[model samples]
Target: MPKMKTKSGAKKRFKVTASGKIKSGQAGKRHGMIKRSNKFLRNARGTTVLSAADATIVKKYMPYAR
Candidate 1:
């Protein structure tokens, strides 16, 4: 059988950590920053882990990820 291909979109948008958690960037940090509050900006600075149920689905699409 042929090797599975990584989902390019998923590869760009989500990351798999060393421990197997799905890490993603915060939304709304790319544009219109002038209207956003400092708290909002600060909160958008970190990555978030996906829930277990959702991670299951994402892992299927990213079969090559660990």
Candidate 2:
């Protein structure tokens, strides 16, 4: 049998926490920030846990992360 390769993109984007939660950055901060409010930008400035359904898909890409 052969070992599976981790998804490079996923590895860079997602993080598996010690408690097994998948954390990812919030979207919408890439551009057009001038139109956005400071509160929105402040709220988006950190990682958030992925939902159960999304975590399942991410886990597939990062088999060793578990």
Give the lDDT of residue 65 in candidate 2.
86
Judge candidate 2 against the unseen true structure and give its global Cα lDDT, from 0 to 1.
0.95
What is the per-residue lDDT of model 1 for residues 1-66, given as tens digits with 9 covering 90 to 100? 998998888889899999999988888988999999999999889898988998888898899786
Computed on alpha carbons, the lDDT of every model, listed in order, comes to 0.89, 0.95
Residues 1-66, model 2: lDDT tens digits: 998899999999999999999999998999999999999999999888999999999999999989
Name the 10 consecutive residues with the lowest summed lDDT in model 2: 43-52
Candidate 2 TM-score over all chains jointly: 0.90
Spell out the clash pairs found in candidate 1.
none
